[model samples]
Target: MQDTLILKGHILHTPSPTQLVAISHGYIVAVDGVVVYCGKTLPSSYEGLPVVDYGDQLIIPGFVDTHAHAPQYCNRGLGMDKELLPWLETYTFPEETKFNDPEYARLVYSAFVRDLWRHGTTRSILFGTIHKDSTVVLMKLLEEAGLSALVGKVNMDRNSPDFLIETTEQSLADTKAWLEASKSFGPLVKPIITPRFVPSCTSELMRGLGELAKEYDVPVQSHLSENYGEIEWVSALHPESDSYTDVYYEHQLMGQTPTVMAHCIHLSDEEMDRMEETQTMVSHCPYSNVNLSSGIAPIRKLLEHHIPVGLGSDISGGHAVSMAKVLMEAIGLSKMKWVEVDNQYAPLTLREAFYLATKGGGTFFGKVGSFEEGYELDALIIDDTSMFDANERSLEERLERWIYIGDDRHIMKRYVAGRLVEEPK
Candidate 1:
């Protein structure tokens, strides 16, 4: 039962947020898609196995995108001038509404999966629209593509445009059916309960969805405190609640289930405490926050508080599929906050940003995002040598340049769960 692959290169990974484990002359051995050995030199116990020598290439764990809209991949870069609410109405919903057609879902989802792999994102948490058939298509495409992901069927019952709105009863029914039918899909591709956001869902709908989440024991993902208008709207709609985070806590949408909240930009001190206390994950979408003018998230503070933080390419709003781009943006945005907002917090380090892009986000999927033994071998091999001058560049500098400037052209090979994803010729 052991099919082994030995990759020799410059290995770089963060085993923990504060620790960077790099082996300049490293050898990683994966047996049946899981890393069994990773060290500076190959052990003699496995001397004769064929090795894939990446030479000077940099080997790192595949990126984990904690938030994305599968249906809105088509909307990237077209509606950058707008903010959250108007962006939703003008660009997002209209494109998502089109997913009611199964063929369109198949076409776009296939491309989205290809692009995700091309960009070194082997695992993700994705959003699909309310249409059940297309949601199934999206799941099938990701499953077929061998990507590890959680794709959700977004739920919205009230205040949405008529074209996209669903009755409270129908929304829950569809979500239940989707969860039940997910048994046949690949183990890596599963469902998450997605309620869109507080402004869009009725109180009754949220409670019912919460009940389903408990009944099915599934993880949940939704937007939280992204835009100023959205936050005020959540407060206005739920007056009894103290803050936007309190609304979800009141409705059983927070703390009880495994949760990932996107865009915690406008979080209050109390909300931040609540998130840390309850072990909630924050998906920092800096590009989307800047593009939508939704203020920068205090990620340094979040990490200081020891809250689980991860990077998300909130596609369309983010305008890029590459986690490499998002990683650089995260560092840049953190520096902006440090200088303009608070100097004591300091700018994010490349090591910390790398952790968020990989292991930090990969936490939701259990043992992923690193080369440590027993971790899933979800990884990428990059040839950024072309981007570097002939002068010797350290392993660290090459990675930095790749984060800020390199593209898919640098990704020579990709592996998800230890299996290579060969680009279609």
Candidate 2:
């Protein structure tokens, strides 16, 4: 018989908005990895199983970071004062160029995964450096760490520094190789197509990558309308197209598969309509927008239009790994948008913001980000005593406090696919 492990705690399942649920599970025979059994008394069948009781700890679904650059881990906080293009030229490109060395890739990638584990992000969508070797290094590290991730080998063929750019043929060949190499990566790690952005990729390269997406049926991720200058640059580069979003649409890259566009801050109504019709997800990286002077994403507008919006760290651009900080930044930036941009765009509440950090983003991966019955058992055991007073509080309050003030120190345990992989000291 497979080993059975029962976790008992105040479970905050993000099912039907925010509700507390009791969950129990064992290997293979779990309730689709979501602990289905909930009650004050254990079911008769669970009586003899080994139970790990977390008295008073808040058990919630593991955090899902919808967008991050794994290669930019070393460059976090380095180019804070510059706007998009200058920052790319002065700091971002130079830092990413260093990943050509396999040893450097291993060192940084290992540390990146460790930070994600420490911060309680068990599942992530990551952007790897353009170097194939380094991208592979990232995949191996995520696998070893037992993280569930969708990672991509970045594709850039034009408008970048010569050292960082690949020829159109070389870009397609390398990306195809990376896809083929990822076939055996197992469920925990999967490959996605990453076109650097509309400006860096020519029409030929973008169309070719779209073909590859069709061949492999993998997801595609890239930037869109992140900065005012970037939008103008895309317009200049693809004058034949109607708008920045139209460039991808013309190349057949949108709607055919799972697509995530980071930072849709300045999208037009037509772009929003297309995104909604195609079901493309937007990764709202608020900190990066504010830090780089990029515009705040109209998240309220996006959600109102039924666009799927999630959160991203956009490291080096935004400077942190903890999705906890991203949650705070998301709400903070929205309030700024309301104050400075439009009063009609009300600020996001704590529940809505936390939902974006968890279930809203986890939708990219089926059935994740909740402890409801039949969902995957990706979870975190958070110890919030540091902020808790002896005074009684509800489970929702504990979760709220943890999101606002907690760090890795508060993550008592982490589980993925019913397997206990990380335990706090």
- TM-score of each model, paired residue for residue: 0.98, 0.94
lDDT of 2 by residue, 287-399 (tens): 89988999889999999999998899988798988898898889888998899989998888777787888888888988788755567778788888888578877777777
Kindly list the per-residue Cα lDDT of model 1 for residues 163-240, writing each as its tens digit. 999999999999888898887897789899999999999999999988888888898899999988888898889999
Error of 1 at 382 (Å): 0.5
Off by over 4 Å in 1: none
Global Cα RMSD, each model: 1.2, 2.6
Query: Cα miss at 406, model 2 (Å)?
Result: 1.8
Q: State the RMSD for candidate 2.
A: 2.6
Question: Model 1 scores what on Cα lDDT?
Answer: 0.90
Candidate achieving the largest lDDT: 1
Worst 10 residues of 2 by lDDT: 20-29
lDDT of each: 0.90, 0.85
Clashing residue pairs in candidate 1 are none
